[model samples]
Target: MAICNQSQFKPISISPKTNHLSNFNLQISRSQTLLKCHNNNTSSLPTKTLKIEPLPLFTSVRSFAPATVANLGPGFDFLGCAVDGIGDYVTLNVDPEVQPGQISISDINGVGNSGKLSKNPLWNCAGIAAISVMRMLGVQSVGLSISLEKGLPLGSGLGSSAASAAAAAVAVNEMFGGVLSESELVLAGLESEAKVSGYHADNVAPAIMGGFVLIRSYDPLDIIQLRFPMEKELFFVLVNPDFEAPTKKMRAVLPSEIAMSDHIWNSSQAGSLVAAVLQGDLRGLGKALSSDRIVEPKRAPLIPGMGAVKNAAIGAGAFGCTISGAGPTAVAVTDNEQKGRDIGEKMVEAFWREGNLKATATVRSLDRVGARLISSNS
Candidate 1:
């Protein structure tokens, strides 16, 4: 993880912005008034609504969590957004017959190298996350069995480990009757991420909470859900080179201390980006997204053809382009789907032309729903 300058942390200052809040509040008030009128006119009304029973304790539960793009250029280890269509699925089953406090990895598939993974709970991201959730919830007697289905490539800078950890945490929480809140589940996922990557919620927070998330502070683990312009047609272009950029290696290349001017510039850019997103200023957002002076300059050299790829993406009509997380993957933002696709293809072509590396590119929307239970069997 890149070290952030905490002394420069400041609130984003923006003018008051209009959203759908007034319309939503108006609709709620009208509905309440109509309900009151109906009750006054009716002789009798049912006071009790139908009660839906909760499902019985399930032996197994399956969940899926979307891939996330962290940093977003300037907000290192703080800002993240969940991307649609690519993610990881995990199934966690309770084994009552097994010894207490035991976790087993029954199966792993989809990103290759299943045989290379360790079965121990302490080693595997999904297993460790599931076990952490169970322990946090005080479910001591139930043993856990985890199965991971990787939809995203490992070490591709697409929050692959975070997705698995988040899915496992959500699956285990669902199997245990959904006792854990979203924040608690995020913390469980963070535990696994800490073991594998580093103790940062930039990826895990959005993977669990969905959409855009800002990690305000790590001391108290403050996560704020930021609103995106849902009315606008925003798309993401993801280009992944056929190579791996290990998170540790990426972090190792970054300087331990940054210049004060660089820190202030990054802070201002990040704040502007957040404010633009909140204000629905797409043009301002694009400028802010493209302005990253600190991390990207140091990390771009590590990724082959990163400079050309970003230039191609911008030339093809993307709002901005930057390293997705640690790199080997580059992300571009656009308002039109066709433009996003074009940007993706251009990025892939640039990667091949510049570095002779074959890459894959895809355009996807933002995933608003984060980790969710896809299936369950009691």
Candidate 2:
């Protein structure tokens, strides 16, 4: 159930100077859509002509958006996938007490420094997204109160902010009867993500749509949903060390220009990673995931235990391992939870022994369901 929109939020502009992704771009428009899907799942955006549906309107609604791993190796700022079992929750309540059409943050509490998050709609990710939805709906007199529950650790490269923004966007849309399309929801989330994180949809797109999303373009906002092989069951080993690598800082370390050789090499690897996922070649996937010649090398050194943890995961038979999203959190993919846990143990031990950093490890499967309504009431 989704619809697309062209309503762009102000003060949050997307840069148009970026290159395009290697995948085919699909557009979801406000009136109609070129994006295709089989049924309800937005993740099924491969090839079937489908209609969009919005959630039922409610006076109060709670929504959830899963955490995501952006970049997915060489597909930096373009590819990402949602992780199951961990995310952020947001609840929206119609408030006649507040000014009509304005948004207010009534509460915020979760993992990381939730207490430190701003309450202003202009500053908060959830608030910003909610407001974006309000604009999309053209409601200048309907007041809404937002409550956020942070499940993902902030600055841990787990799409924490994106989850909050996605949840809040969907919550607001649900309140007004799901008129906004899926692309509109993503656009709303992107408004918040670009303000806080860099101007990229790699994190927010997958957080809103679920599963894997490949960003084909930015200017017109073209997206393509990429799904792994249905027969292959992939497990993610996420180890979040008690370290903060802000998105701003991590992005700062990236080089402005890379050699042509490096570009070719990384391009090939990115292609292989996508192919491996499609063909169920775990070994290929791992090699491609770990073979980032440019971004990972520079970023890895910044995260104290990253190099050792990556080595540890590979040593423990992980299919592929690399820094998740930004950094400080290392993510590895494998075929089984048992193997994933074993890899996680080695990575954790490596962080302690080498980097002298404490880390927590969790294993989860790929989230087929991205952002969804958790509960609602009149």
Candidate 3:
């Protein structure tokens, strides 16, 4: 509805010197010797019997950062994107005595639930994923300490939790000489997610592989990476109302059954939205984005002034407005950061008027690069 037009795009760069998250250290590598299966193996050792070796200590420190956005419109539990605008960091160091099954986290920084941080590896999704990946690779005994730096806000619909889980899994894999494939790492990441958000691969997959992903199936997990094709400039504004709406609560509110017409409409919109993104058709994408017939309407009422905020963003030149993940936070797309800021201001104003609640809005861009190895100097 609301569209903002401006000329300048903000300069985006990655900075390494400044530490936004708490510093951490650790390493994951394979065991050096193979276990003998039988005396016959001395003459013809089976390939499976090959000894797993521990990777040499990292030549330099390394960091893995992942960008993520949950509930990408109609594909609740089935779609997500690695947003370049925000992410989390994992720093690890090698400890020969640390053993693979053991993982310790220190230097927990950023805004996170302190109680959640204090838990052991078995309870922490991120820690579990990291440790699991290492063990599966035959690094049975890894000794390392991890420092998790959370950049995204907790429970803000920004996928902060997923990013942390993804980054840890990825960083540990890379630290261990890349023992796992991209998809394998995603599977490991989802193991952590299952502990909290149930068995969902949409968010974790994208965070690992990067780009726009379509979760075609869940059980045997099928994922498709969609290319972003846009001729016109595109940007995003993230506005979190500083509230928490658990994904579980939102999913519970959704109807397990939907009208035939609603299903057809939502399917069409999802298909069209994917096509529009690939075609670089901003207007079509916007229309499709706002065309969710199943989830938004039912859950919006729970988010205070969602309607007013959406209306205000549209009025202020946002291509379209939608709940960021579940509820509370809203996302607006525009051509430039300047317009995004303006739209964010208007959206916040609208929320104040309708729900009498204050909200925070930030201008951002689609993160095309996804999760990346920023530097090895952990």
- Identify the candidate with maximal lDDT: 2
Total colliding residue pairs, candidate 3: 29
Q: lDDT of all the models against the reference?
A: 0.79, 0.82, 0.68
Error of 3 at 216 (Å): 0.9
Report the lDDT tens digits of candidate 3 across residue range 1-378.
111111121221112122211111111113223221122222444433443334534643455555566565666667777767578887776665566557777666776453446447766666877776765554544477777787776677776667877888877766765545565667777788888677787777788877677777655556677777645567777878856788888878989899999999998888887887778777777777777888999878888889999899889998888887776688877777898999999998988888788888888767766666666743
* Runs in model 3 lying further than 4 Å from the true structure: 1-51, 57-60, 112-116, 230-232
**Which digits, one per residue and each the tens of the lDDT, describe model 2 over residues 116-155?**
7899989999999998888766555557899899998789
As for TM-score, the candidate ahead, 1 or 2, is: 2
* Per-residue lDDT over 1-378 for candidate 1, one digit per residue giving the tens place of the 0 to 100 score: 111111111222211222323433343344332211111212332333211112226878889999999999998889999998889999877766657656788888886444566677789888888877766544545577888898988888899889999999999867756645667778888889999999998999899989888888766667788888778667889999987788988998888898999999999999998997777676667777778998888888888899999999889888888999998799889888888888888999999999788999999988989999999986
Model 3 global lDDT (CA atoms, 0 to 1): 0.68
Task: Give lDDT: candidate 1, residue 222.
Answer: 70
The list of candidate 2 runs beyond 4 A from truth reads 1-56
Kindly report which residue pairs in candidate 1 clash with one another. Answer: none
TM-score of 3: 0.83
- How high is the lDDT of residue 32 in model 1? 36
